[model samples]
Target: MERKTKLALAKTATLLAAIPALVYANASGPDPGLTGVPNEAGTCAACHGSGTSSINTKGGSVTVALPNGNSYVPGQAQHLVVTVADPTAKRWGFQLTARVAAGTSTQAGGFKSTDSNTQGICSNSQLRTAQPNTSGTCAASVPLMYVEHTTSGTRLGTTGSVTYGFDWTPPSTDAGKITLYVAANAANGNNQDDTGDHVYTATYSLTAATAAAQPTISAVVNGATFAAGIEAGSWVTIQGKNLTTAASCDAGSPRPGCRTWSSSDFTNGTPTSLDNVSVSIGGKAAFVYYISPTQINVQAPDINAGDVAVTVTNGNGTSNSVTVTAADFAPGFFQTGRYAIATHQDGSLVAPASVIPGASPAARGETVILWGTGFGPVSPSVVAGQTSSQAIGSALAYASAPPNITIGGVTATTVGAALNPSALGLYQIAVTVPNGAQSGDQPIIANSAGKTSPANVLFSVR
Candidate 1:
């Protein structure tokens, strides 16, 4: 078993070594290239000139004079175009095909691609005998050397060249071959039929690879989250296993590699454009970017109302989803004398908390306690209707103020305004029964920000 394994390994290595480095310009055809009779003489010059050749092919013939070449690169969208001549049939035409080898055709075996070709077209034929009138375009999938586009004089012309070649990313080997055939038909001006086996051979080999790999996409993360109210031009951080990775893409590709976290990548991948409020971060390998993934930092991007979601794709077979909300995120509630209001974690007043106890309008003294969180400092305030004229202490005095205060509907007069240090978490503003003030589940408003304790001051004036 060990000996057999060694032999197999040896065979594989030998096979790979036989493969050439490149293929493109190393075509096995005419020396310099046999596009027409004038090009044929150039083949002989290779032996004379620096790197020239005199291999040429015209009507009814196909020629290749190179000694070595390499495989065709695939993603590069590489391809070839050739013209052949079929001099036989009363009406003559030609067929074209391709053959690919792993090595210099001498060492490793070759494989024939069976894909459709777009380069196969008739150059000269009986059907095209009217000088430049060629019919039918012959296309095939490449990586293979086989005869096709066998046009009859009735459907084609003679005396011209049949063009064929390849289109694909050539493999990383050299032993590749592209062969062509010329066939004539009865309609050909020659007035005779050409056999099926008529063909011309041109073989060349190249060494090592002159190309590189195709753009391969990769991501480090799989998804991200977005806050509501998409702010245009914000770089929404996206995480995925390959989000930061860069794909080289094809050389012939119109789109070059995208910036690591470009919006184009996400928009192009998905039919719809990325939400204006979001975008991906850029990098390579385990890519990284800043976008809210989980609990938002208190100092980080502000939270908004409504839910938002994001989808991140690595473009290499993986993706995931992220969710967000529009509701303001708060750590605690606000104080309004047991009647509280909703505020965001940033401590800004939000939804007003409904007054409870459901009592009818009151006209005298009453007390109210505000409840919630983050009441760092107590601020002075006044109701919409009453001004300094409704005096009752530092809380609210009408300068011997006659009007009092209203505590959640029950009117009252300020007994005293309790002022505590900013650090104090709670306070008790007390008031006495008073007249002239009326209310129905009305609120005891404040004039300052961040004040929550000692809800309302009440007083009385008989």
Candidate 2:
């Protein structure tokens, strides 16, 4: 009986192993077809069969169009369109791979599909444990990946040809040249695995691009994404076309005027403006911190409780006026999508996501300072763009209800809440992490009266 059971198990295993091949053979095309690896597609003739004439010359061809240009800028995303043309073809499919043109010819850049009909899979690398046994199967560890049409995508084809659109973000640094190896199939509408399909392969090349253009401003937003409206003494960011002409701000270049700001720059209650660019709120200059081609960091100038006009002027041109409301005690914290812009006592940044050595996470019980704009009022009210070298000599004008802050759902003590000494409109708040606070990333929020900040703000709690 044991021997009979073993034979039965072996027979069942054999049948299971044959299922993939059976599915591929019976289907109109190979199930889950391969894509993205250059010439390694292993000939479609394994299932589609070689036809009477050249598939490439059969009045059918595949063309790849890079929307930006034939050349590319490293780290830039380009929309790619692949179109197959055959007047008589009713169904269509395609596979594409990008690789270094020279050296080992390894894969380069990344591919993303925007269409629901197209699926992107690594060559033999992106495979299901149970994949169809067809040529270019993703069952093995193939170095390339492909983005091709799905069964539904193929079924959507009625006549002529079909086009697929996707996005490709290239590597940060140029990898000499990139070559895309593509294979496209024009199939008969009859829905059967036979000799009626034509397959064509082609190669396209792209080079690196040079310097582009300078910065431009689109909209100015509070540094804290969760908050609305810019307030006097609050951190605000101006975003628009071409904000950063080149690389984003870094330690070496720093953002223009960020590190050099001083109390005297805004002395006498004049608005602070950087030499590179100037922002005006209600006709008064605002304090400028960082400037990129497409974005500018600034402190909102002190303004009355009314609708205020704002504008940014750079070397290229002056932006159209954008009006915003001003109020007291509009508390907001500068934060990324996941974490607040916080710092340690030593002034080092708190960046839990950074892999850099000194970019450490905040620990429980530690005091960290968060920066943002729109902390309503302070005790010794100062004019917009005002600066002082000495620490604030008076108490802060706490909001009517004051702001309540919490970390990871635990109420944290606010140690300090005052205007930034170096720039107006930028407020600083120091909070101590509570003992019972959970570790890892913790959500943080500040509320004043009935106004609550945007949701999902976070900070790292080690």
Candidate 3:
């Protein structure tokens, strides 16, 4: 048995090493030149040979999906869904490039990798002309930007086909009409580099809208409590129209109504223009969370307490500035339904549903930590948009008195309340379960500086 195991390990290592470096890296396609549209050379047929080469226009196709009714706003950070379909194919690969329509193929706009499965490659015709044929080349006739499949993106055995999603930020200003050229390969799962594959080409056009309405700011409210007001370093939501292309989104996993965001999209501390949407409070950029056509969510940056100008910008256009006031403290707890964002001592969230192993049904005597936002300032202090991968060691800027916490009407002793180190404007409270706490779902309320949490949230106890 030991000898067999050793042999299996050796075989696996050898197989992995034998795979092409490009395949293992999962970066982009092997080469861009073979996409056929730019170089006019055959696609996968260049390597798999022409004898078995076949183009299946009917069986397989490539499509690009934009949110704005097929029209793109200048400098808008929008997600492009590239799909390649074939019912019988076991493996898939794709390469795509965008350039100005009619004129030279100079690369237009920009592409950013939203996930690890795809990467963006930018180059011009001059650069492609100098490179050796082995490295792959772009057309010298026009500059282009390519988005291609990585190793893991080469889905195997997926019944129909696969879709590659990434962010494409258009040019800051109008670039006239734009054209996209895509090449896709559908291959049999067999490991050999031979025939039994089909390659297809697709072209799409997008028109830049000059008359698009600028984003508007209807209301700005506390991110946690949804109250009409703002505070420094507090999460806030700006409600308006034409602010983004999509209507609704959640950053975590894509479950039903939620949209999955890549790990690289949301940074903790510093402000960013993800999706080409940004909110500036008192002239400072706030850390953006999610943006939809009607709403923009963000974390307010540090500022002095007073009326300030708040504006939302999409691409090169900025909305009319609105007046908003900031205060020293306006505590608001984050909630899902009526349950406060609390967790067990082990860091597993105390949710009504047991999503993680042994994470639900809070028991008496077990210490749990509650999470919130708009709890005021922190001792060590943090920037609005700076991202921290590790925990921060800082105390929360409390009201005149410490916060009062209760579970199911039973008073609980506070272990500690501090700013959650890893996230900005987030607060954490450690408390022990009360002896008389109810054994089912119960109300958990927290009060700080005279403001109380919403009564609709709940937490489970066992």
Candidate 4:
């Protein structure tokens, strides 16, 4: 019995050896550039449909699902899935490419395979090859890239439909618009030839997301009082939309909090722009200090008193010019809510202890320093956009005229009134609290150059 079995096996081996080996084309992967992209050969149908006009038959469909609807943010990555479906299909495969909508031959972004079921192809105008690395990046000379199925991705003889997933990163800058071209095959699983397969082609158009609206100025006001009007060398606050691009602290960005211009942001002079955000007042750039989406703090440039056009320019575009009255002196006191921002000689804050942690009310007869802006020009006038610098004892850059300051309706003795030497557009006033000053919140007002500080401001006194 053993000898008979050996003879049968030998006869079977001889019969197999006598037959020709069957070769299957595209069993590993299709050649490059078959995604039906513009200027490319017709989809897999060029090789899979037996030269018949039956390609793109009605029984099946190819679709691409994008995570971000029909718009893409520049430099953002999106996961995508390609699905090929046919009720009678027993195998599936697909290929896809993204091209700039303006010029279909130009690549729009990059595609990378997310799993073993897929692979990437890099192609030049004339030739194509497998991507050299997992990043799916192509050589600079070969700028076009495509993503398609690997051999195992075919799922031969096991499916009525199949889906492949990959990731696509949009260009770092807006590319206008983009289109994805995809071609898919739903095969019969015969493995003998490409005759009985269905070919499908689809294209998806995506637009660059509309950018944040250009900055819009709703109001231009004193940075200290939030009142309208501005003055040269004054701290001005621009109230607007889309003033800056930094995300707020609550927006989940990876910084400590909202962006504030730091010392490093200055160069030879104060930065006139921050994070590509700039302000032009009367056609002169303002020195930018703090920036946020809804507000910007800037030191107004030196300009004559008159109506001037104010505008903000940022990454998106320029805002509509808003006219604002510019004056030589628009005096304002920096305040914490209704309380004037004041400090004792030792630098401790003067406020209701409950208003600020570790704060105490100012004592009668004590000398308190008050902070403000827009006191107008001083002697040895400091250049706009430059830091204020003056020797403390040599000569003080005092206001053109000593400001008349009254607290609780009683005129206080003003000892010092000048621009703070260590800062720009900032002024400090030294005053002696009245001997008979009443306790609790006291109205504080400063009048300079005939302009009065906002009337509602007050300070805590005891």
- Using TM-score as the measure, which candidate wins? 4
Over 4 Å off in model 4, which ranges? 1-208, 250-257, 390-394
lDDT of 4: 0.82
Q: How do the candidates rank by TM-score, highest first? A: 4, 3, 2, 1
Against the hidden reference, what TM-scores do the models get? 0.27, 0.44, 0.48, 0.56
lDDT of 3 at 192: 52
Backbone N/Cα/C clashes per model: 119, 38, 15, 0
lDDT of each: 0.29, 0.66, 0.69, 0.82
lDDT tens per residue, model 4, 1-462: 999999999999987775433223265556667888767766888778665377667488999999879999888888999999998888778889898999988888888889988887787887445443468567787888888887789898876689999999888899988999998888887764567788898999999995456678899999899997579989999987777665554443433214667777776568898778899999999998877888889999998899999999987779989999998888888988778899998898999888888789998898999999988878767778765563343455888777888889988889888888778888999999997788888999888878889889988897
RMSD each, Å: 22.3, 19.3, 21.6, 16.9
lDDT of 1 by residue, 164-227 (tens): 4444333335434432222211123332212222334344333334344222222222111121
lDDT of 2 by residue, 320-411 (tens): 77787766656677765567889998977776756334667888889988886676766666565555334354445333344678888888
What value does the lDDT take at residue 129 in candidate 3?
A: 29
Looking at model 1, report the run of 10 residues with the lowest lDDT sum.
291-300
Clashes of 4: 0
Residue 460 lDDT (model 3) = 83
| Ranked candidates, highest lDDT first | 4, 3, 2, 1
TM-score of 1: 0.27
lDDT of 3 by residue, 310-418 (tens): 9988764799899988876667678766667778767777875654455587789988888877666555455555422232334444333457888888888887777
- Whose lDDT is greatest here? 4
